[model samples]
Target: MTSGSDGRRPVLTGLGAVSCLGAGVGPYWNALLAGGAAPREVDLPHLNMRATRMYRVPGAAVPEHPRRHAGVPLGAVPRMAVAAALEALDDAGIAGPDRADVAVVMGSEMGNASVQEERRGAGGAGRPRWTPLAVAGAAVGTAIGSRRGNIGVGNACSAGGYALGIASDLIRSGEASVVLVGAADGVTRVGMGGFDRLGAADPQRCRPFARDRAGTMFGDGAAMVVLESTTHARRRGARAYAELAGVAWSCDARHPTAPDPDAAQLVRAMREALADAGLRPDQVGCVLPHATGTALNDAVESRALRQVFGPGTDRLPLFALKAMIGHTSAAAGIFACLTAALVVSRARIPANAPLEQDPDCAVWLPLEGPLRLERPAVLANTCAFGGNNSSFALTGPGGTT
Candidate 1:
């Protein structure tokens, strides 16, 4: 998809990730192509939950320098965000004054929950007060030396997708030429306990689209991307991986934590995102679905993809990323988009995690091996608590400049 007449469509020029697979975009993509990492027992103190296993990032991969930012003590979540954001800026070849005016937008549901949890766990005496929940964006802004703005998106699991969309708007509207978009989260005691109480967490592993799928598993990490206007990238001679051609958001508001069984809003979001990108359903090569391993969510997304793609749904390759990295909550959307961008640039779709297909979820998911991405564009879906849904499209590098 070409940028609109204004040639201001957002292009993805750099990607950085910290995940269970490892740090950096290279390890993330390489591990995805190699069947992805498995979940392991995580050490979440005060988390009295049966579902303790998660796709936790390695200790060595997380950076520990810059322990404090703007007087706010940094925790794992903000530290991961800073690491990923700096990597993205470096990957994009953005430095010095060039980074000064770049805006910082981050989506985080639990923000610095680990910091708060630590304070509470330690009786909150003698130690400084805990950082705010929106500290990740500020942390990123300071790390990148950006004074333009620090915006936060709190749309639960779909926050990352919303952050990307907002960054695109910033560039297209001439508000900024370059924007840093990212998301990060660490395990939170309340989040885990609430999921356990609601019976919405899988104890063994996340098995989306499986006949006996239990519930989604939580993963912690950060992913960052550098989005720039097409003209800006060309001026700097930066190579783009993909064009963020379309972004659409919708709300179901049907339930606080459950998706609407009918999936009306989700289907609409997918269709509208394609329309926004000026793409036909047949042009999309693959999909990164928000199949959270929950029985209802997977089934609903399966039906929703069918509604949007119709007959093409049968042949489309669906990459169930959560099965590999577990659900990153607010970071899931950015993770999916990063995966989609890689799929578009590399022309290959990674294999989905192994599972026994559920007849109720009829969408196609190629688990045999890596498949060639034949089409030009890739689409991704992200839905969150309160039925907030987001869908976006990325086209091959050739579709950009």
Candidate 2:
């Protein structure tokens, strides 16, 4: 089933976030409007890379409970996921008993790799517990008392978008009334080392669509949103932030690490997602592009936007969220979605991070300040390695074609 003006449509009712800005949704939104936070030096064991800056989560922001899951030491990633999940459940009014049937879906490329990294740094002289990529979802499931299925997605950076799509399908197909969908990733030695080795780690900050953009910076955090069927939400009198109208996915098997320079698959994903939502290119008020400050990625996405939106693409407000929050990798898609939902609910669009606009990426970005959201519907795109791409559309409550 697809979203529409019907009872089966999926709508977002609650949001939770833990980012460099802080731990709550209020702080995260306020920071975005206040021009975002600056990157800081992060000292990791054996991290000997020229690019040492990242939007690291403050020590106080991580939760203290669930220190260990089944004898495996829970790292910052799982802890942050737990915190965000609890907050989202509370916001959605899903008490412990009510959440027994709620399903959970989380996306994370690295998962709790930090625990293993620490062990390796300590000479591997401890118990043989392993923290796999499913730890984040498992941690949340255990915390929320969710007896239903718990699925973990690892589609590289676009994992969060895929997870959201799966949750929406479950709700629409009558398999679950509500789904706790989220993504979480903590900066790991391997992730940092790999990027540094590939020369994709930006030395300064994340400046997407910038002329002098070097590469992308990594950020660590978790974001969660509670999605429920329109009928179930109305039955429970749960307030909705926005309707998740549509989602589409595609893959460009042509390249393993690089996006197809022609961007044919990316363009198709955008068009199909809009079509699924029954919206025209002109109806989308804003977009959150997967602009990761990479040279070719930014340029290719710019060309794709022009192809999908035509000449009017210049007028669309593109929220370069990664510029402010850094690329949260696998969690980025959900973070972008949560940001879009806030734009619809609050009727305001946060300003983009300042940058010397790149001519090749000729997309409009409002850097002056927050602007009134003239249109209610928004679109967000996410791409990952292996050429996996996903796009989703969202509209405000009571939105009509």
Candidate 3:
């Protein structure tokens, strides 16, 4: 990783999102401030399971953008991704000649499982179709007229954080002046069924850190951010939301479907990420935890926090986004990132509404209402199945530039 003295700092200029709360960043931020659960019963006939509730993006809320995959079979994941990418580009004011050198990076877990199921149900007879996993980057890049390059990340739930990290490296290395980073996942029969088989699906809404917490329920959504080198953004006079200070990745390799009980590797990831950003744990005013509402995940993450933040961990305001939007799977990390960026920029943490407190999960979570940030930096964490872990340090526009 390059140091801040290297003449480039990756900065976020634009954000886009499609989630259960609504489409666009404005609606998503508003819903977070409203502080209520938005999960509804899953109505897909093919996805019959014991856990029936999920947070889904309303059809009316999906943005209608010009399709780049016309006549090609596309899935909801890529569609949502393209919508988000377009919004990010527009928000960043990167258009016409400026987009020629931009890149697109996307991430997902089960790419287009729903589309695959649909094809299989149709007797598997069709023309050559583009898989959601294969065409996500291409579709978004083509839609935005970005011919520089396209990359896709499939690192489970941590894919979004990985995508952002890679995008920042590209900018820091002078490979691209602007990059669109994002992730998307659509709730599918195969995905829900797999979780049901594992008995990790929650029938009720996600309630992270709650004593009665069961497991995580899946949500369908996509989130994207426009990252550009500070020099490039300043040259264009673009407004910045936050600086993408640093990001680090790690894996525990403990279990195929469970996080390591010790959380040593997770702790290293967070500490290294803070070091990479040239910030201390005490400097991080807020944390966007990967609190999936599972009994083990919440407890393990709390332990990791205590290890990193020490005595200050008890008061380090943690925000649980999944409780409002449900777990967005691969897109969960970026959702947390976007929310944290907004929190730091706005200087206010959104309220967390866990049902009840769990004695084991003793992290500082503001359940009564929102809290003001005395510091400017925020840390976002993502821990995925198969032991993939990622951490990012972000600061407001006035942060480290």
Candidate 4:
């Protein structure tokens, strides 16, 4: 499986993420691998997301910040992105985002929650007229730029993961030498209500791979990584987090809200990724699943994993991040990928919270706790409501400082 990029592989140079676990990369990473729980509930402004406990980033985590482009107010999307991207930039040891070798791909499910609220209510005082500034700020791409390079990407819950795939493709296509890829989504009234209506919102909490797990809780978060051609990164003496090995995408071609449980196409997607990486199924160490806590989704994932990874699906350590971070929706895939890479880089897996192993889900889920490994390859999986299935095969770097 040769990389499409002039045969040059792309490597992960930096990573940053914001979650209910913590604010910046350090805090977020610390909390994620700690295996602890917080007294958290659905925390959103000007919204009623009750009967659910979620992972909310502290207000301090998203402190007031200036917009990337002056005039734009640094709102939730930007706040989340800046925290993650800045950390990545800092890690990459590059000041200023004006490098021609860089490219940006930012993904979001729901744009700015605050802005959407304003637009929906703009009806206030009179038939609300759309504000140009408001509309621009709400654009997902504008909220994320490298000052160096820019490309905005969005596709429902698979946004971030797909954006990462796009970034890898850009590099593989020889369009860019280095790329910054990220994903962000926040808890808002619209998002909460939508899921609540779908009967997928767990009012109490999020429990992934749990025997009694109900559903997912909406969460707000952003995750970013600096990816560069392996040659470029190695030449610069940068610390590599993991190899952005392979990525693949497919549509259920089945249904809008339901996954193709038979997994014919979904399994193909995983096989494609494995082929792209020139790796075999047995080489994979863990599985980073998009277990949304829905009965249908969880079961579909289980069936697919078994088909691809064999009965070992039960033995594979399935790191269920949503159990702790809730579902970041569009940012979910990328966030899970980042966490998986961190596991390889840090040599320690992040534990799932509120995870109760069910006879079904437990057989294939690493529900008990985190697992440690030195350098390992993992598959990060995500599925969108429209039968969109995406997967990224990643191998963690050798070491972490």
lDDT, each prediction: 0.89, 0.90, 0.84, 0.71
Model 4, 213-296: lDDT tens digits are: 666776777888888887777777888888878899988887878787687778888988888776688778778888888877
Candidate 1 residues 25-71, lDDT tens each? 99999999898988888776666778888888999998895688788
Q: Which ten residues in a row have the lowest lDDT in candidate 2?
A: 1-10
Model 1 weakest lDDT span, ten residues long:
122-131
Q: In terms of TM-score, how similar is model 3 to the real structure?
A: 0.95
Candidate 2 stretches with Cα past 4 Å from truth are 1-5, 124-129
Query: TM-score for model 1?
Result: 0.97
lDDT of 2 by residue, 329-352 (tens): 999999999999999899899999
Backbone clashes in model 4, listed as residue pairs = 5-172, 51-203, 52-203, 97-148, 210-356
TM-score of each: 0.97, 0.97, 0.95, 0.89
Per-residue lDDT of 1-401 in model 3, one digit per residue for the tens?
23464457888898989889887998888888888457887766655678888898898866554333645556777788888887888999988878878988888888756666776655648743544455667778787888887988998889988988899889988898899999999878788888888888888888899998888988998899999988889889999989888899999977998899899989999998899888888899999999998889999999999999999998899998899898999899889888887987888998897567899998888977678887888999998888999999998763552
Top model number, lDDT = 2
From the highest TM-score down, the ranking of the candidates is 2, 1, 3, 4
Tell me which of candidates 2 and 3 scores higher on TM-score: 2
Ranking by lDDT: 2, 1, 3, 4
